[model samples]
Target chain A: GIQVEQSPPDLILQEGANSTLRCNFSDSVNNLQWFHQNPWGQLINLFYIPSGTKQNGRLSATTVATERYSLLYISSSQTTDSGVYFCAVASVYGGATNKLIFGTGTLLAVQP
Target chain B: EAGVTQFPSHSVIEKGQTVTLRCDPISGHDNLYWYRRVMGKEIKFLLHFVKESKQDESGMPNNRFLAERTGGTYSTLKVQPAELEDSGVYFCASSQDRVGYSYEQYFGPGTRLTVT
Candidate 1:
């Protein structure tokens, strides 16, 4: 089984600030996704970057497959950004199903 | 297009009681999955369903958990005589493809279960 670890287990930031979260995997992965779990317990899909880089609004993510790590950047964060961000990956050896293995997550808080 | 949807936003039951959760994936999605986070732990895969067939269920905690996807539509997860350890948020996700080559999963609002 592959291990996924996320850094900065907890963070607090003022509104309009910027932040970066990192995820490190122990093995190569065929699938990787970043999610934001809002206070309402809704898991919102942020990005699906198995490799390379992509941006969506104020959020962006980059994954270095060779290094087995991913980075998520949040710029000009707003108070609504307060939530838990998760990075989940499915190892290349996971076979057909490729069920996701989730990280502990980074709890982000943005205050006004 | 509608995203994945789950039934019973929250459930509270006593230990040893039976409970069933339902998930309806997005239309046209062939891959449906179930995962859960227990006691503030990381979310773990419970199973995967490719249409009406069970692709994998290795993540199921024990025999008390049973999942079924009939007619290649909605899926149901039944827990017979649930235990306190089962208290957590259960999430259902669906993807348009087999989960590789850029196919991403869309999650439903989780169902929070509290077993007393």
Candidate 2:
């Protein structure tokens, strides 16, 4: 099984600040996604980047598959962005179902 | 379009009792999965169902946890004689295609289970 690890276990920033979260996997993966678990316990899918880069709204993500790492960038962070950010990925050589392996989440707290 | 949905948003039960959690995937989705996050721990995979068959359940923790997907539609996870360590958030997710390339795996809010 592939191991996923997230860095900057905890983060705090002003509402307007920007931050980057990192995820490193033990092996090559075919699909990678970022999720924000709000205070209400909802897992909001942020981005799905197996490789390359993608952007949505004030958030962006980049995955270097060859290097076995991914990054999530949050710009103009809001207080509502306070939550746990998780990275999940499915290994390229996994079973037919491609079940995701989640990482130790990065807890982000944006203050006003 | 509706995303994955889970029932009984929260449940509290005695250690010796049994509780069942249910998940309904987005219509037409063939890949359903279950994952759990215990206190102070990373979320871990439990199992996956492709239609009515169990595609992969290698991540299931132990025999006390049983999961099923009937008619390849809604799925259920039952924990009998739950233990204190079983208390955590259980998440269910679904994707249209997992065996091929890659697609989004929409997740439900999750069910908070507390074993007293």
Candidate 3:
């Protein structure tokens, strides 16, 4: 089984601050995704970067598959961003189903 | 387009009782998946359904959990005689089956299950 570890288990920041979250996996992966579990418990897809870099507005993510790690950056974070951020990956050995294995997640709290 | 949607946003039942949760994936999606977060732990995969067939259920905890996707449109997960340890948030996700391309999975608001 592959292991996914997230850094800074808990984080707190002022609104408009910036932060970066890291995710490290134990093995090679064919799919890597960043998700935001909002206060309502809705898992919103942030990015699906199996490799390379991608950005959406104030959020960006970069994945170095060869290094088995990924980084997610939030710039000028807002109170609405206060929630759990998760990094999930599907191992190459997962076959065509691509069932995701999730990390414990980074709990982010943005105070206004 | 509508994203993944789950029924009975929350469920509370006594131990040994039966509970069934439903998930309706986005239109035109062929891949449906079930995952849960138990005791505030990491969300774990339960199973994957490709259309009407069970593609993989290796992650299922035990025989107490049964999942079905009849006609390949909507799916249901039934927990028979649920145990206290079954309390958690169950999430459903869906994505298109792209052969050579990797597609992002969209998740529904999870169902919070509490078994006393």
TM-score of chain B taken alone, every candidate: 0.95, 0.95, 0.97
State the lDDT of candidate 2 residue by residue for A12-108, as single tens digits.
Answer: 9999999999999998887799999989788899998999999999999999999999999999999989999999999888957778889989999
lDDT (Cα, 0-100) at B19 in candidate 1: 98
| A90: Cα error in model 3, Å | 0.6
Residues B24-116, candidate 2, lDDT per residue (tens digit)? 999989999999999869888899999989998998888999999989999999998799999999999998873554667889999999998
Compared with the true structure, what per-residue lDDT tens digits does model 3 show for residues A4-109? 9999799999999999999999999988999999897778999999899999999999999999999999999999999999999989887888889999999999
lDDT of 2 at A75: 99
lDDT of model 2, residue A34: 97
What is the fraction of true interface contacts found in candidate 3? 0.85
lDDT, candidate 1, residue A5? 98
Interface RMSD of 1: 0.9
TM-score of each: 0.96, 0.96, 0.96
Which ranges of candidate 1 are over 4 A from the true structure?
Answer: B98-101
Reference-based lDDT, residue B69, model 3: 97
After superposition, candidate 2 runs with Cα above 4 Å error: B98-101
In the range A3-111, model 1's lDDT, one tens digit per residue, is 9999999999999999999999999998899999999888999999999999999999999999999999999999999999999999989997879999999999999
Which clashing pairs does model 1 show?
none
TM-score of chain A of each: 0.99, 0.97, 0.97
